[model samples]
Target: MTSKDPASPGHRPGADHSKHNHAGHDHSRGDHAGHNHGPSGEKHGPGDGHDHSHANFLGPNTEMIFALASGAALIIGVLIDNFVGAAPGWLPTALFLLAYFFGGFFTLREAIDNLRQKKFEIDTLMLVAAAGAAALGAFAEGALLLFLFSLGHALEHYAMGRAKKAIEALAELAPPTARVRRDGVTSEIPVEELEIGDTVIVRPNERLSADGFVILGNSAINQAPVTGESIPVDKAPVADPALARARPNSVLAESRVFAGTINGSGAIEIEVTRRSTESALAKVVKMVSEAETQKSPTQRFTEKFERIFVPAVLILAFVLLFAFVVIDEPFRDSFYRSMAVLVAASPCALAIATPSAVLSGVARAARGGVLVKGGAPLENLGSLTAIAFDKTGTLTEGKPRITDVVTASGVSEDELLRVTVAVEALSDHPLAQAIVTDGTARLNGAGIPAAGDLKSLTGRGVYATIGGETVWIGKAEMFGTDGIPALGQEMTTAVAQLREAGRTTMVVRQGGRDMGVIGLMDTPREAAKQALLKLKDIGITRMIMISGDNQKVADAIAKDVGLTEAWGDLMPEDKVEAIKKLRANEKVAMVGDGVNDAPAMASATVGIAMGAAGSDVALETADVALMADNLAHLPFAVDLSRKTRSIILQNTILSLGIVAVLVPATIMGMSIGAAVAVHEGSTLIVVFNALRLLALRNRYAESPVAAQA
Candidate 1:
């Protein structure tokens, strides 16, 4: 048997395809000659001659090269001193000088710059230690100190580069050129040159070059790179009123595709909705860059400690040299001990401890399609005790579906459904779509009567004229309230029963009579229950569901997802108030996916946006953005943050503990060479420890609760 194509309309048994003509599109005939397309269908070849040259002449590899050269020179100098004592002293001196200049030149320059700025950095301490070592006639030890210190710098630079490259890789995902169709003719053009509303054609297995909605064709899109979703999502034109209304650029919500996502083996045409620079991928790149610049709590503390510690070390070195001279100790020996003190007390390891871990954590999160705005949010995630979630899109799928239908005694189900569909077709609300979808499916190829004079009743529902009859489809109160047709006891009881079952119920009226009551529910997301359990396992004490949805629906979803509490029928301001109340007790994080939740999210200690891959509002407002719509990555983020925090603490203590042990050893006549080894060794250890966070992964996979549910 041939493998079934899930993207095809007929893949599901009993799916209605009469309205969609899938046979006419030829996916295999869209290949254009002389155009190189990547696996994701993004057109290859440089377009617009965009220059990517950077001004830093040293490049990312310069430090490593200098470090290797200095190390080799230091080794050669030591060999000469040990085995060729008869050789001229100048020979060993020249080699040592070469090593010092090559390895210590940058460090000295940075120290001088810091001095000019009235800042005492770890570089300053290293320079002072090396200078004193040289002055004390300990050229070999001084050269060794510079070489080891430079090697540490090189390794730190390399570690930071790896993290930076992870974010930079996003820029390479979008192709430079795109194939645009204008006036029915397709031609290759620079992606930057494509304007809004321009139609772009993407062939099979190509990456989308721009964010847009598909006006035609059907396909499956692999959005793993942008959203961290493992499963490929099916793409087709679907009438979603909420998406259309919220994102005006997206004409058919289901047909929307983002730049950098790989298209399946089906050709589709998309109308460009956003410019190349404004694409979701570009926003991610920008956000990641910004996040790297924001300092974490630990980083700030380290900086503050360095500001005081560096100066204190300098004063202590000076005092030691003065006291030794006053006691009639040899000036050279006194200087030697003072230099050792500088090396032992330098805060290089302490300074790097926090930033390295924070950067690694941020990079690791980015690779998994989660963006932590900066070190602050990354650090904050570890401290969050309670998390508030918006129900519609955070805990639930946000897509309403008709689940139950109750018709009046004389009215047939088909007649009730037909009248409902005809009126709901005029509405753009999520519930309206559910009614129309179920109604149309049950119609079985039967044509829906035209709806006329459609009027929306704000939040209540819709009013329309269908086949010359005044039909109303909305909340039960809309029909029974003052000056409107009152619903009978039978229909009211039916609506009440549906509501008690946690379904959003609406009454259908035709010609001023109650025809039926329809029940619609936005089901909980597949991963919601498992994600909640995982959050609890990760030490999240309080989980609350906050939503504008009715109380029963909110409570039902809260129970389904294992939340500790549920707050319902809240306005945007009410959500903010609820967050304030939660924050009064403990650190609270708010997770949501809409503009309405922005205030509440901002009010919480940390704001997390779900399904951020497509929404600019989520990208801009939330502190942390879970690129995908599901909560699979939420637990991972929390675990990673806690790990990062723990690692920073470990590094800080180890670094300080080394200085505490080594400084006293230096004063007690320990060799400067050993002091240098201990000091530089601690720096390396801290860096390598921080690097461990880069490899951290979720220890537990998402539970199978979602599948069971």
Candidate 2:
């Protein structure tokens, strides 16, 4: 069960799986020196001034600034040309020239790249249309067209790049150098030079340089960066060095720490176990970077649309420009109409409609501790009709705790616990570990007497000789043996009641007396029930639990959580079959935390991994990952996706509607200036509409489960 709960519950921010405190990532650390988050929500780090990488349809950094400058010049030129009757003709021409230079800067750069590949795309069409407006002696209108076009692209890119920038921010969390301790001498070396088995000294409040095991000191580690856990996990040497160091991947759980997580108070020395490139944070960066390239269906559609539309528009413009052969019109008027029609029909708004929304939605999800890989998953999440959850780690606490303790009439609770804890301490089962923790805390330093001669009853329980008495702890069947005490009617009834309440029970017997029954249960997460309620409230009603636990236990959890259905006693293949059935007609998403759940997750429309921060398998396999352990993020993610989908549709319909109206209006004698205003105005509308997704509401503020938990 602890396998499902890797991070210790006590060290967790809320001390349970319910709190949103983990949203403060050791991973989402924007607090480090030289990192500033701008009003645009872009996190700029040292050495990462601004990325002017390959031209995004929405430009980046300097391109955005240039676009704004061009807008300023165009506005001044328009004022001089129309309002100031006596203004010098050259003044507006010079201003329009500045607008053209600024507006065409990034567009031409990207257009040149496309031309190099012999691809006649949207950028080329935009440039030709603007140049035609200039050719018709409508220089101010052309400047307005280019200025609006550039400004739209720049603003769209700025808003849409939020997710991409958030991902790059992960790389900035790692320190450039690590202080190495070798042969009692310390020196700072580049983090890349740190290797496996090397010792690195981490000072207070400094980010860890590598994933490694604690060797020298104890301190509180703020693991929000790597684990998305808000509470500071205590770091210290393993109780037994010979054991923890010998195990593989000891960096998992206790005794180990990750790179980029901050150390608190005490300085510590660690033996590096993973190279900087292979650390968990690095893997998340690599995986999500790859996800950015996985294009959404809408993006692919537009790409195909561009291939056909760009060529068709160019041909249509040429035919319209020479329409004197068909219509009784002057070439100048015909050419002017053709250029206006071209500007009207440009797909700039359509091009950015989906990408802008997708980008903003993805970034917003990340900020909320949900990593939405790309647009496809984000779009799919909005339409899911059913959600399948793997029960153990995802829906339940995954770590069993002693919930109820019953004592026999003559036996005291302490006495029963003393004998049982002494016998259970010899076992290595997860249940035994949980029992030891409970007993130790309850005992409060008043220790139990030494026990010896332990003997396990196969398929039953264990018994040990403690102070000349045989103490037994296991199921009721372990009793009524030749020398052991029998579970009387009262004791049997108590056991049955505990089982009916969905707890694993064990009978404690001392000598010839039946001590009592102890009940253990892997409780549901604090917010699990509320999250399910929120999901149903949001119209995702067909919630189901598919678990490897027995039918009884699964049904209990399902009932507690208000799930529509429940299935249990499933093998990995059985889970897959269940998800396949659900996916037949419904858009299904499978959420799980284990590798065993991967098959079923793959079979669903979307795979969401719960508590994916430390699980590499979860990160590699899921379309969306809830970085924090809180179940509240699940509903938040679904709500966000739905909002994003709505925004995308709104932008799409508006884009097409503008083009549809403008195409005919321009041919019907709409001026070039009017077409440019309407066309670019629609483009800006879409960009700003998509940016609304960036301001996500607090999902848990109204959640009763979240509040109570």
Candidate 3:
């Protein structure tokens, strides 16, 4: 089915009414200027940037020709040494040095780079080890070491490109233009030119050009491009009663369509709802990038370890060299043996273990439709003791819709519906939309009357004069203590029944008398029940629902989701307290999307926000943000974390395993120092194995095909 907009549709009523003025803009600077320029300054395709970087080469094709010739010479020299057994010393030496120089140049440069950064890198150790091997008359082994290390470096670069491909793919999904309606006529315009209330016509086989609602006509849409679900959704006029009960399908007239999803076969028109930068897809990209930037606790510890590790290795190498020479050993043997020790203990495997796994884990989460902010958050997910979810949007769909209308005090249903819709028409809240939409439909063919002097009481109710009659509509509590007197047992009992069904009950008053009550509910997501059950099976110890909604609504949802504890009617700060209490028992994870929830999000051991069009403040504060609000991915992220941690431990133990056996072998003199050289070199080999995670593909196999396509 079509994907819904990432933002909570009914949470803020007037949010969609804001002006969107990006029409007729020149985005040539952003889109066109990314192309590469050739030597003569002509714009070229992607691969043409190589011209500028290699311009100072000895000549065109010179480097390529030299490389091939040098490689051939080295191959021939090795053959002669293996077969003839008596090549001239200089020939073997020269050929070996040439191969080392060409293949090892980048490694040497990287060594220098690490030195400049005031850190010791594995490159420097490899270089030292290779030099020592050559001095020990092991020319072939030294050359092979350089070649293998270079090969590993190239492979790592390619792996990084693959890891980043998802983001690059997402950036390319949106098309640049849209069809906008102006002055009663449709015209082709850049998406930037879209303005609020401007009807945009989306044709067959095109992406929904902006986040907007249907204003006219009908259509079906393909939302799999963004939602990771492969279903086509049907849309029609809002007046279709049968369609209204069909769970919205995320496919209906005037329903929000995200940026990347495609419009289906039927043609329909939509009103521009939000600016391009504010679209769901845009916010997901932002959140993913931020997550990549924030370092995890493990990453920080890795950095600290590297700083001390390099100096310690240097000291050990010097001490070994001094002890051998003072014992009357030859200076050459002593120095060379010292270098081998330095190479063997460089800690390359340790340095790479954390960040590489973290990078892969984040990418995996994105594939599952979750956007974890950084390595730290992903690591924290596994240790969570409790999870606090915001009730309005997190536990429920967050969009309230009219469920039932009842009349009392002899008021007709038609009269009650008409008055409610008229007053709610002046409001922009989700509850207001639910009431207005349902009221209008029930009125059926009744013409709307002009509403007068409509005044809204923030967070409460509304007062308006419609058809020359003053109407008051809001919660029973809104009627002041002395005004409505205490509630009768019957009224309270009725309200309790409505609340038990997870509905927000608001009383309707007319001419200072109670007419009846209306109930609205933010329906639960279809997949939530199954997803939460899966979480429990996978060892999620506790789940709690938290919301700014009233207590009755929160408890009803908590029961449905199988959460024994629920907290409602909380301000942002109060939610933080609830999270703090959960944390006192064990690690707590707070998940929310409102700016009001930012403080609690930060206070929790891990904060997971809804990144798909969620607020900037919430995205920034949350340790993780779901790029799409697909709850199934939440469990998937947790699974990836456990796997990543296992891989890291394996790499650590393997590296240390080789060291433990080899180090003592050298001290006992059972073998020459050459044996230590072989063992030490194996560490580099083991490190390359751990880096395989960087090349992992389809870790989240069910990720949206469009993310790759």
Candidate 4:
């Protein structure tokens, strides 16, 4: 059972995953570096100077600054005409030109590209109308409108692009080179060169360079990058049966391995089992790419609408032109007015409203270590009704450890521990590691011999000779109930409690006598509860946990995590059934960390997979993959989406609402320039509001009031 501790503090600053400590050995000067020519590509430069390649026209606030400058110039020009006498045409012309080229050049280029593609893009229309207005001597109006709109577009693009880069860059955690072992020799080679069945030695604390299986040694591995779980997994040799029985994708508990995960403490030698591109990181990239293909009803409708929107705008423009001509307005004035109407109705702001918001949201999510694969899943996340999680590896640590031990009359605690740890030392089970670790510490320090004979009994126990006495370490049931009283009620009650707490309790019997009971549980993360409370307070309801463990174990964890429902002993199909049941009425999100969770993840309204701990199948099936293993990320994602949706609505309403009030007034000739100015300025305001999601919150501080809404 995973026990969560919500109050844990942040990690050590500057503690990147790339930094590895090799247990008093500096592999940096080892033979591997001499063979690789790794430094051949290096070109050291002064760190003080800027890297020109990283710099582009895309400067922060450039768009907003251009918009403000152009808008102010237009308002100044109009004010000169309205209040002071008319300024010289050259003066206004010069100001307008400054704004036009600075603001319009980039936009015009994009507009031209769209036109070349035979697309009646809003940018093209806006450019044409703004230029036409300047030609008609409404220089100030044209320049201001052009600048503000262009700024919004640029800012939106930058924010969205940043998010895409973050997702694509996540796989960089895996080192490019791996140490391959062949014929008892070690050589460093690019990770991509690795193939199945090759033996690779991953030294202590180094990230696994590729996916493989443990061939020798043992260690604790922290796989938070793929599974998004922060806990480290203890690994042993494949000889341990309990670990052997673990699901194949669970990194083989002892033998199997993954790419891009770090060795927490010890070391392991693994045989390559998967190709580089088939690794967990690659699968997440593939899944995120595929999620873009899934569309929401709103998205589909909008795309279809955009297809016809341009032609419809043309018809409206023509109608306006004819009406003005029939009303006997001056030909030039009527023509420019008609163009303005088309520009105003081009849906430029509306076109950007949803995607810009979604993109910003996705990018913001990435900054906070959440990956929202597409607009559809992002939209679903905003309204999630129920979230179901697999108990092990999803809600809990998945690495079960020995928390308690009890012994019978003749066996002292130390003797029992020593015998148990000795037999377990011969195996690779997580429980075995716990016993071996705890027992080794006590034995070596106190000079007790680690046991031997160490023959494991299939599905039962280990047979070994300890201190000249034949010992059998396993369950009471492993030895048939001859005449011994069934475990006492208290023992049974204790076992029940352990199971309820999501523990896998194992009984250790030595030579037909009950030696002791060892309880193994996967404790929950420290941040789970606080994050859950934050989520609930923010409007989430009906949390659930689904697991392959027994009902007693599942129930215990559910109670602790504050889940509203718990289902245990579920197969993949069982999980899907649970999702189906939940989805019968409301949106459901399934969070999981194994291959078994794949189908159910796909079936849910929104599927979240732990990037650090999950297998390729599970990652591929999920709509959103959390780069960090903290479940708190789910609620953080939800918070971001909801906030983004709110921003979109605000921008949509603000833009359309201003147009509703100003468009009619402009048509009525009541200071149309000022009305247009307000409309344009408001559009810029709303666009900036949407971009604010880029600032990710690092702490669970009381959210600001603006975010609360």
Candidate 5:
């Protein structure tokens, strides 16, 4: 049997799963005719109760009602004891006991449950304190203590609900019903019923229902909630070589939209690529929920301390009572002092210090589009001394661009470019996209003859039949020095110059002769240099660049980005080895974006995935995921993690220091009312201190160095 007690750590008060319906019918090619089908074929309209604007949660109304009643009873008991001196003694006693029972009942129940489980928590400490006060004939004071304690617990419950509400609020961003078009007819249907390849029409100001690519029309999309990009990104139909090659049937090869992003002024139709449950928004919500369940290092330490502290305090209080009794002190004085000791030493503030800070830190990071998987990662990020980065997609833009095109003696630049474009257009390599893009611009819409019998030579290049001639494009070594005698000293000099400038040189050949050499470079991000400086400013001493590119290209990029070291021509396993070696000396963080980097990232002390908005693997595997492809977030994450760790330490010290000071005072005859006030005040102080983390802003936003031109 599961207990419904909210105070129990295992009890999740508002965790209701009945609202989301996972079993939904496929509406991809269904003929709707006139009716709209909601979940399970239920008829739905705009006015139907499918609105997700408000997410409901079972609030702390019950706890509030009991606290209010207890407060009223305590007031009346105090009034009767002071003002109505002639009143029956039993009247005040009954009123005080009523307040204590009403306010402390839930706490006592949780304490008993915890005791049965062989665990002790704040509830147990609170119960013992209240009981000891009542045993000392301080009924009004004891009742007051219970009322305040219950109020604090209820407020904390409400605060935590608000924190969780931030995640729940993401669900409301997606409408329950989506306007889906199938068989040339459009109808409203449950979002969960959406399937891949189904056309979804999003009107102006409407939230997207699934991850998809635009098939028709144009619009701006606000992705702040999903990617933390404050400005709306313009979307239009344009050719994307990668997507065009990978998804030939994709309606709009240009624009991509994610679920939960709001459509701007224009109405756009998107073909769904992911289901509701698989959307980026859903993953974020799921991750946040799971993150909250994991304990931080400080929280674990506090729990361990409590395990020893609670038992030791109880024994100490009993020892004090026995010692006083053996000294022939009056029973009243002995018991009163012992009760004071129990009230003072209770670790209420210490118990909540770490979790409160961790929750706020996680929520703050989420607002900035950084998803920290759990508290362990958050703590680990703070201590990272060296950071390893994947060059292509992490520091560079990941999109290669043509820098120089050199044609051999007889081959004209135009002829070589036209043949290269025709052949590379059929390929999906990053270099292929660069060639196609540059060639298309130079051709100016002039049609090039289609390449036939195209074949890709992995790691070398591509071959195709263009203009009834066999054409080849790839590495310089593929053509061979013996066969391409025309590619002499001039070609070698040009290739060396381009490679020295950090460009990837590709050799183009046709009919067993060198046609030309094209230079492609995945340039560093505009913000990369500044971001590296910021990382160094924050005490990240070692910055290393790792890449599968040639050593010369890697060294050039590393020099441009101010990195301390660069490792090139390394395979995936080699990258992992490098990360492990770095981890042997100090805490290391690996930043990467592709599948090849996943293993290395996993091996690092903290794995950070850049541009995780599109990759589900990055979202699931990395310890930290930066939604945007920008490197600027790295320093911000590091700074925030450090701040969180510092705050946790500060909170721990403040809580423990208060206990150390108050325990001695209580044993020396501190009043029960004074001990309760100070104890509850310390807990409140710790909570407020944790809340301060929520106000921490991006320190690099306007830094002088970050703003340098």
Candidate 6:
């Protein structure tokens, strides 16, 4: 039951196959940012001078320490040169050399590695610029450049490390062992040793071992850790097959449980259906782990930008270095100006701008229970122009519910509900149960007179003795044919109207007269309307519903939920076609149940799966999985991604603007020291700007665990 590799198993085909290289990272924290990829997708050979910035050559613990050491040495050298006139000139030179030694240690290692790999990176650019400064007798400027570059690099890593901590926490949710009950004996064992059909006992407050059916006992399960569902759901055994088959499209009682969900006070036993490592939690961890590898659109553009920008900057620096020779200017001045320009236009900030934002966005989304597959989907969700939703289990509650209560002229609404609840409370039919459930909820725990001697009229409805009176509740034809008087015109018209509106109608008769009509259907979720309104407010104007049900039912649900359009009688392939057509004109997102509508979802700009908590298929196939199955979270995801995109744009503007300003300033007498200070500041600024997404508040209410993130 090992988790699948995101890159190998679940990847959508035709994705990028670029040769992505990291600008620099501390591998212990697992950074795989996009940088240094060639447009031609060619592999590097030896001596290519490719930059692989290993900023922490000593170790993660000493990265900042080394930066401080470099600053200390440079400060001491400056003091000797300016304040101590009696100090030997060789003494300041020695101190500056020490500063270079401390700061250039990791840079030197990376430059050598890139030389061996035959590729160039930002590290090579920094080293070359520093050397040019030193060759022009600007030892102080070169030392300061090295010191600031190393220090800024260290600070950037420390800040991004804060965001990665949340991602690492998600991987730790599932336990490594399980208590197995076998041959009437219970024993603790490694989860890997448990096979399908094996019985696992879960005590109160214990996380599940694997995805499985609860075969015995019942308990409320807290699924917020894996599913993002704030409320705990009661788990029970599967219903009897015979009883479940009594009604068509009746909602089956939920019995399937997922790994990593905590059991409540009652101990339960589950039959393992999946290997522990292959559970949905494992796949979520895998997806988040490989997220950086799936480069965002901005990352791809950065890669291409660097492929040309690096070589061009190097050529420009060389031309500047020798340009003064042709005009008989001082060689030292020409060299110093050239070095400053090289430092100014290093593009170091550009290299880190997108990846930093993308990484933080991915971690933030996961913390909120939205599993964004990669940076590509995260950006795509923000850019989506339209969204199409699946109906069953998506827009609607996917089960029957009492929708309306129409009363006679003299009868009050409570009276109709009270009489209906009393009669249906004694019945076992699915429709009857729905009436009882909704009626009880409406009654707000009020006492109701009981019914007795309930009689079932096959193919019609039921009759029960209640409060010393007989009541008949059934279909429209059941009354007139069975010694029962037909309903008056108003009640009759009300029944017909409810039917036309795609609701299941139940006619209530008492005292030989029509009392009222109770209408039932798989009603829309309470949040569906508000969720759609939020989507519209967020600029998604073209909202649509696609369903396999009849046109009337689909349209009815769509109107109830505020969708802009509805399409019914759609097969799986029909849904795909609809998505492709919508995608042809605009960027579209297909939101569905995750498994059944995969093709359609894949056809759109981004595929969002609802309630993906326990389903591996949902996590693997869709671009984003809303683990809670709540439509309310959909808007949260979109809003977060939009915020992420804006932050990335801010970073790009600031990073590139610094370079733009510094280049001209350098050629007009900006010192190499000043250029390096501003260059390093821009790089750190880009990183901190991206980190702002980590704190972006989503629209949904956060649970205690999510609030901690």
Determine the backbone clash count of candidate 5: 0
lDDT tens string, model 4, 375-487?
Answer: 77887798887788887777787766666666656667787776677678778866678777767765666555567767766776667776676666555465545443466
Compute each candidate's TM-score over C-alphas: 0.84, 0.81, 0.72, 0.68, 0.84, 0.78
Per-residue lDDT tens digits for candidate 2, residues 23-90, read: 21221222111111111222221122232343334522566677888989988988898899999879
lDDT of 2 at 345: 84
TM-score of 3: 0.72
Against the reference, the lDDT scores of all candidates come to: 0.75, 0.73, 0.60, 0.61, 0.73, 0.76
Q: Compared with the true structure, what per-residue lDDT tens digits does model 5 show for residues 670-703? A: 8766887788778777767777766677776433
Best by lDDT: 6
lDDT over C-alpha atoms for residue 4 of model 5:
23
Off by over 4 Å in 2: 1-106, 134-144, 154-163, 213-238, 248-256, 265-271, 301-315, 479-486, 560-564, 701-709
What is residue 679's positional error in candidate 6, in angstroms? 1.3
Candidate 4 C-alpha RMSD relative to the actual structure: 12.1
- Per-residue error for 131 in candidate 6, Å, reads 2.4
Residue pairs in steric clash, candidate 6? Answer: 48-118, 48-119, 49-119, 49-120, 50-119, 50-120, 51-120, 51-121, 611-629
- Per-residue lDDT of 599-689 in model 6, one digit per residue for the tens? 9988989999988765667887899999876887888889889998998888888877998899999988998778878987887778788
TM-score of 4: 0.68
In candidate 3, the residue pairs with backbone N, CA or C atoms under 3 Å apart (3 or more residues apart, or in different chains) clash, namely: 13-428, 13-429, 22-192, 22-193, 23-192, 23-193, 214-254, 291-373, 373-624
What TM-score would candidate 2 get against the native? 0.81
Q: Measured by C-alpha RMSD in angstroms, how accurate is candidate 2? A: 8.9
